[model samples]
Target chain A: MPPETPQPQATVRDVTQILTRTRGLVDPVLRRAVQQLHPHIGEMAGFALGWRELDGTSRVGQNGKGLRPAIVLLAARASGARPEAAVDGAVAIELVHTFSLVHDDIMDGDERRRHRDTVWKAYGVGPAVLTGDTLLALAMDTLAQAGTPQAAAALRRLSSTLLELVRGQAEDVAFESRPWSCPDAVTVEEYQAMAAGKTGALLACAAAVGALLGGGSPSATAAMSRLGRHLGLAFQAVDDLLGIWGDPEVTGKPVFSDLRSGKKTLPIVAALASGGDGASRLASLLGARPDDVTLRRAAGLVRELGGLAYTRERAELHLHEALRLLEAPELERTAAGELAALARFVVDRAH
Target chain B: MPPETPQPQATVRDVTQILTRTRGLVDPVLRRAVQQLHPHIGEMAGFALGWRELDGTSRVGQNGKGLRPAIVLLAARASGARPEAAVDGAVAIELVHTFSLVHDDIMDGDERRRHRDTVWKAYGVGPAVLTGDTLLALAMDTLAQAGTPQAAAALRRLSSTLLELVRGQAEDVAFESRPWSCPDAVTVEEYQAMAAGKTGALLACAAAVGALLGGGSPSATAAMSRLGRHLGLAFQAVDDLLGIWGDPEVTGKPVFSDLRSGKKTLPIVAALASGGDGASRLASLLGARPDDVTLRRAAGLVRELGGLAYTRERAELHLHEALRLLEAPELERTAAGELAALARFVVDRAH
Candidate 1:
């Protein structure tokens, strides 16, 4: 990925408008995805999504940022592709992302998500698991409906990315049992590897699939993927910051929630490695089952130990790299500007 | 399907031999299925298959009947289609079956399968879970490589069947937890619906896919699927019998194993509904944990209650139905005869 490019602040607003408009355009496709299931499959997925238990279906419906599909559709559109040609591809990626989230919540034993009961907690594990499996099948089923070989190529990217996501999850789970310390002490390269697999893979897949559907040349698709990779890395670094230090109102999740779970986020690791007395205290509390007060204290300890500052710096570096990739000559200037703006928006957004 | 036209018994034996030869031909394809995974996916599946951790690759691979894939190939060959054309389709079905077994072992907390540690026990729950997921992905990936529209159709069958299997599993799990028995007694019809989803869906998918690849007419393919459905029902009934009464030496599983698990197998349900002292005795024992002695005694009680006779009659009925379906005018007689022989073998086998 390119590591040097003049930062363009003006394009940021342009990308935000594009994302907002594109999300509206994608709603019908999401509805079609949910509607296409065989009667039983649909009922089960609905139950798993807590359709009956929720106030309405609002909690499980298309309520998210829809960031991944937005990346997909915008990339397709920026390349002069007809939006109609690629909606299914975008929906396929979104379904895959949703599938991973539902299953991951179960594996992690997380009971609440999107401010409500998770699939497993709502419908029970059996139904939730089946629902996830159904969504995955739906994703594959979507590919057959892709109008060209481009669909095949997009699906290949999605599949490979899914494998990588699972591998990253395995590594994350494995790390929980291992003795590990602060974020700052570990090599930055290791952090990048984890982020790439866990976060960057899907983003790259999204962009590449969009490019493929948009009829971009192979090289252009490759460049778009790289741009997405850097953007994903930047996105994750910022997310790690909010996990510990952001306003709860803005992020929706409780502050320092990652710390309470003993997550090994970038900032926490960095702070452990870099801070003086605070680092020692952090190590002692690393895996402790902290109560709310203790968790808040732990977050303070991490910041005191320099986690926040170190994380912000890393996010900046990733952002600069993302911009460099977006500025490559192979991309059309307007599209490149929009993508670069998107990358900046990702790192700078509150939520 | 040709229940009326009883082909000579000798013709059935000849077809079994043909099936055995075809299995020999497809053995390499099975190997490819195991080997095609990234080293991790392969190793995890192997580990889940209960390869002893003591340096050797372990021995549980010998346990499966390989029934699903065998039927797929036989159906393909019966249509004058090259067995080679069905190899990938066959492998895909087997892997999917294996994936289900791994997850079901966890959900059921089944410690021993085929008299060895199940995947969850051998590899731990987390690894075993991922192993199932990996196998599922591999199944889809393998189907994608079929390089024909048939592959897409095969994937639809494979995935839709998976969804059905999960639904069956949910019902099974829910039944086990409920204070009352399944609201609908375990009647032949209920058992048929459960077994069709749990056992027959995959087999039906296998036959349908085989026919698709084997150049069979759509109607002929539909006939073969009906044959598979009947065969699968018969197979599950025979399996239920072995779980309770077969000699441990031949069955691999301990005698009356399903009774200990409180499984609502046909025999127990049929016996429970009977107004007999033996039915009451069996129900009392079922409510308590049964040791080997108790289990054996329970099996005797079920037999005395006529549960075993009832189960045998149902198996025979299904086997008869399957044979009739195979005898349908559209079917390839040679193939249908072989499938009929296979169904008979399933219902009559000691194990």
Candidate 2:
């Protein structure tokens, strides 16, 4: 496995270092893969990936944190597989991640991402949608060309995970128009399921694919998948927290954007389920679309009702579960330590 | 190859019988594949495929004509491959075809398809988009699971063809916004390339995949791809003709719908390229959005300018090229005859 690189004791700070190094490894592969698409599609996809400007000029910009690819590389390393061997898996997962983001921005009517205009806003919805579709097809093509013994299984896993992602997105959109008092109102459990599908499935697939491609045992792969799922849940919980309370400058969103849109995020659902004056007030405020003032008031009520604390607790619990999963004896110690560091960083990130 | 089925004299009438039998073969495979998706996605995909009502009630109605799958099966049989062995390939092609249609309907703002409300119109754009994405992922998964020795090659071909299809669609949308007076306006050659990518790529992939899975020689597979490409072009030419001149009741479109929308279809492009008095009148009529009366007059002008005759001649030329490709000695005689019949039927169909 290319002899484990010597490392000092791992700390939460090491997670950033590891992620940066992995990004350096994965970025070239990602760029080259996108460049291989048909010329027009490749140009749009490159713009969407933040590797180029809309007018076909080269640009260096925030191309996301590359967290999914990091998970993939880390999982492969933890399984005592050569991290390089999993590069295609990493590329494929990142492509899928970018695909979902492009489409999601269009569906949500979000104008900005990463402090820049969204693809739909910058180019137009038609190109944005086509760009997303092209990336998806490219993802499958990338995996099939990986030449790994496990390519077929990885393709199957990734494809099924894509279906889960789509299902989760479908449910999220459906929830928007549904009334909370209706029988079909989303339950907390259903919301968690949706989160698993939307957020967790791809993460889990990433880790599992890494392990599988790295020649890990089936049990090791399963543990990595579970670890990724828990980490995804925790990551989402923290994101929901940020959506309400984080600085707009850091989060790249308007203050209380989720609340304004009446998004049924974890904290809001918790607050609603708590059942008190604060919950009642929050519910009434959310029944219709909220203006900035109403959205601010709703966030205050959610905090007052301990919704924020409840969400933080859930995030902590999932983080704990994720770390526990990493304790499996099959994992290489140095890589497992790095994974633990990453899990902590996920919950602690400001954005 | 299943004892060559039986012998019968090839006639134009036989195309319908062959197509109907092939549809019966492919429909159940398509259904089962959709059913295997997660419940929510499966149900939505089922609705999109016209297998069920939106509310999950059973319904029997017109799905598409299943032309792509029929081509796949026919090509496989002609290559002396067991038709049953190519079912997964057929299913995958149909899924990709449906995926493109679902998204195209949304992009074009077409409210109806196959005499019913389009998926986006009936279920909203969000679900329709997700449904298309899910079907695409499922198409790859279905092909990978087919257990053919050629499965990897098939997956690669399908993914690449999908990229071409997306590129073509992107260009079509881009052309809609570009002024004809602009220096970079889509020319006749660009229109032909767009049509090749949009219509011909998938059809070519279908035939090639059929031959590959059927154990055809490389030369035979290349011939099948060429045959399919020519046939696809001819079919599109015929379709463009119908768009301008056919009965709405048979074609399931409003009279002069393409003209009303100012679609830069083949006949219109021919008329514009002709550059005569009639061409000038047609161009002037098309410059602005045309009402029904203007659209009717534009169609008349196009005919007077010999646009209709030019399109027919082009379709016939392509049909001849397709039949010439089918003359390869590698093709099984009976299957080749059936394919020729199908080609004739494509250009001859009123709708």
Candidate 3:
């Protein structure tokens, strides 16, 4: 039997309904993108379809929420940019994300993703590698067809964003082979740098491209970029929380998989720095081949050390900053409200 | 030991000497590109020095012979288009070729290139991959800054060429894993398709982009593209010949490396289809484990099966056709002769 999808919104208040509504607004744009991508991508049909076909049901369920693209649209709308002009840029970033995920799965030897066989596991390494490359090429291709003279600048933004993305992935991979005291004991500064490189760069790109293509004012684009960057930080913090504490049904991975893999998520970092006997024990147990029981024990130790509380506080601080940034400049009230609501949704929700 | 710097004009026969002479005219424009690319390229500092840091040999080399770029330049010049106007397009395609070589070496698991360790082997996979990606991005960046409005159209040519390169790689990888037999012999038709996808696509792109960027007539660009396609085919056939028969010291690879890898290069395919005892022996030897001795034996059998003779005839035929295409609609006499000279150089080289 298939695992149940997590309903993190059920126990959450206010933000649940806001997220759902915003998602509704974003759905049409995504549908049109997939539609356009499906037909006009004929020359690359074999390679393009090969990537799309690598999933069994992984792509069907528990795929990453379309958060980055939504951020692009919301930020674009807030900055008085049109939604249509921003959608392709949104699509391009999403494709980059998907491509990165495919390669990361291979590098990590990950077998399952989003509740199904990962691309590398299903299609073999060479094809999976090529699929990632094809997605990247197609991302450039889509950005080029951005329907305006401003498309060139938008593509430049996308290209720089990709360079940053590769840099982030390199850091992450390099970290994996190095020594670690505990799964979550990474320095806060290091954590922030990784988040900014891996997550914030693309989010900033999404907003910048959208605004550029939508004929937005330079100041407005800068404002949106600021908002997007903060949102990306908050989003990653929320994701790190889900990796450690969220239910397996919702996340579509074995609960505490990050601990098993020795990932140093935010909470663990805070807990490790606030050291005690438990911290020592946590350090020893990490990279020690944790089973389910060990993972539960580790979680208990993290909570006892105040890691959980510290992470939550940091996330809340960032969410507040994001909200403040969103309100700093001239924007349509409704668009600003939507962004504020999305920011709240990111922090408060479980998955 | 470092390889000696090959002189630009010394290596060229009659066919390519004129191309070497034109190099003097294009040096200033090419240098401008090298300057522009330097600021954006981070870790490619050694490469920027162009054989300087490697083994401390600062002597000038052929500067990649400028074959592909010159096609772009001369084709543009032949059609009443100024050489100055075609430089960026020329530089862009050459950059793209160098970038392709970097990535293809990684994909092919090659240890040595340009008489040195391949980028991935020398610098580690992450940096090498980034270098290739950076160069690809830089190509697009350079193309976008073209001094003409037709830059967009030229970029489409490069992007489309990239798609073809990926397709060819996919096909090559897939073909390698399939069962080996004369039944699986790639027909001349399939060979043409593969060559078109791999070699011909970029050559045609070089000529097409040059014409478009240089303000040549549409008919001229189309004719040049046709000529380039045939020239590329002839070039590959010669390369296949060298793969089997070239001196290892000159080629910088093991002699008959293609046979050991079971790469059904053109001559081998032609030999397998002839269906004689020698062909049978060659196929059986290939299907068995290939040591140095077995590969040498297989090479002898392939020769006896008329593979080398057939490939030579086929290459000469394509070279003749390229010359014919160059003469059609009558390009200016001097330019047409230069192109014919290039075709002969491409098909008749010993290495």
Candidate 4:
């Protein structure tokens, strides 16, 4: 049987309902903050946020899952503040999330996200770059203008997280130019560090910012950060799995997108490191510029080489650790339960 | 002959000496802050900052003039604080200025700056983008971690300036796509607005940040901001003139760069707005994708259309206003004299 939170199941907020509530609370603030940009930049930002079409017409489209925002509001509530007190934190983190997606699309030359054209795909690269810059600036402004020590603390953390994002991205780009199977190739340890910076930093900041804004004790903030880091690791592992095996219709990417791009994700790195017949074969498949059928075969080789199993194990391990933190007696049980649900949902999502 | 300040001329610091002194005070802090980044990211940042060669070899190269840092420290001193009190402000502003240069090079696909390949040319576009983001984050980190209310206020203002920079950049990009000679073309008023956002915002932020960090009264900060804005406009007008007429040897740019790139700068707009035979011929020159000879002719045409004299007059006009602000009773006399000297130096510099 799966482990469960200490709170009664009936008393727990369903993850969907929690996300719906968060979207309602965060979007108003988020949209208002985005509107503070130049009108043209705001339109681009709106398109990135799924609130507008490429032509600047209003549209209801697929948006982010709001997991980061949910983490913020839930962490704040668990720390004993009303969710409203941390709304700025939520909006700020969400803006950062969107900024990363917009910039990453350009960096990776990705054309589609959320089954729609990416910001760079719809707008030109320069406009997309400005949209990302606008969102990041707005994120900083939101926290800085709050005029409180808590906001300051949160801003400092957020700022550091921005560096981590760049650091991780720098590493990711560097990886592409390097060999895939030699000492010069990226290592498991190196990939972990990159993932920690790229995915974990913002998630850790999200929870910590929420707790700090909610007037939580330093210890409480640290606890939230630890849990968030584990959750981030879990999220990345799940994403690695989806990158290879996920449905294109669901993932909004080409089938075997990671394999096709020859991205040095966790599964590929683990497979390469495994050192066996399947590992050698997997490397050969990747070394060849893989087509769709070759990519599917490469996926099978990655699984046979134990890369998939090892990655899944890593994800579950992190997820369990994150869920275990919810048992801390200092947390509000209901909110903790919701966070656990959200974490599980993230790992289980199709995209 | 130039007007002189009320202070004895002998007491005014030489502009180069002020810049050299400021660089000494600010680079250590700036360098230490950048080194805190991931080694790879820091390496690219170091290159962008002119502290290293592309291959990560440390080489002293041409750096910025330290004008922004000088303003920051001078403003702090004028506000009755030790220059040391505002070193972080100086560093932060310098980092932001560097970030703008790195990103702008990539956006404009510029090849050279300061007699060297631009960051995007030295490193690839992706690394250049990451370098820009890293510098920006370091800037925020330097101020945010200061953990003082004064620092917080400075950070808040700096955050807004980031938006202004983007807004300015966005307008600059938009200007490229619009007509150059029609009613639909960029207007003089619009050019000023863009200049403020692009150039004036950071300068204003620099002085205000220094004032705030140095414990200057809010009114003093506002005064510094006003002076800084006027100085920024002067700086931009001088740059516009340089863009068209500046020697490649001094400017570290191709001669007639603005015209070659079809940049709708103030000089171009004002000349076209003059509504004369020369203006119409200038427009035709630009539309024809001018060669070396045509570019020279276009430059001559702009001068004949009164663009050159008008731009010079505008530069002098703003320079006078900025220098006049040094007469404020609240500022220390020696520092005020230095600021006036620096403001004059900026507009007069060949590059």
Highest DockQ, which number? 4
- Global lDDT of each model? 0.72, 0.83, 0.69, 0.87
Report, in order, each candidate's fnat: 0.06, 0.56, 0.12, 0.68
Clashing residue pairs in candidate 3 are A6-A250, A183-A264, A184-A264, A184-A269
Model 4 chain A: weakest 10-residue lDDT segment is A4-13
> Model 2's CAPRI class?
medium
Residue A13 deviation, candidate 2, in Å?
A: 4.1
The CAPRI category of model 4 is medium
Please identify which of the two predictions, 3 or 4, would achieve the higher TM-score against the true structure: 4
Q: Which stretches in model 3 have alpha-carbon errors above 4 Å? A: A1-59, A72-82, A108-111, A145-147, A173-191, A243-249, A252-314, A328-336, A349-351, B1-66, B69-91, B122-131, B145-148, B182-185, B275-281, B324-341
lDDT of 4 at B142: 86
**Tens digits of lDDT, candidate 4, A221-269:** 9999998999999999999999998888888999899988879999889
Candidate 2 has an lDDT of 0.83
What are the models' TM-scores? Answer: 0.81, 0.91, 0.78, 0.95
Once fitted onto the true fold, the runs of candidate 1 whose alpha carbons sit more than 4 angstroms away are A1-44, A47-62, A145-150, A181-188, A248-254, A268-342, B1-42, B50-57, B174-187, B215-217, B248-254, B268-307, B321-341
Clashing pairs in 4: none
Candidate 2 residue spans exceeding 4 A from truth: A1-13, A38-40, A53-58, A181-184, A276-278, B1-12, B38-44, B52-61, B181-185, B276-278
Prediction 2 TM-score vs. true? 0.91
i-RMS for every candidate (Å) is 3.5, 2.2, 5.0, 1.2
Per-residue lDDT tens digits for candidate 3, residues B199-254, read 88888888888778877678877888887888777888888888889777767777
Give the lDDT of residue A95 in candidate 2.
Answer: 93
Model 1 chain A scores worst on lDDT over the 10 consecutive residues at: A53-62
- Candidate number with the higher lDDT (3 or 4): 4
DockQ of every candidate structure: 0.24, 0.52, 0.22, 0.69
**Model 1: residue A44 alpha-carbon error in angstroms:** 6.8
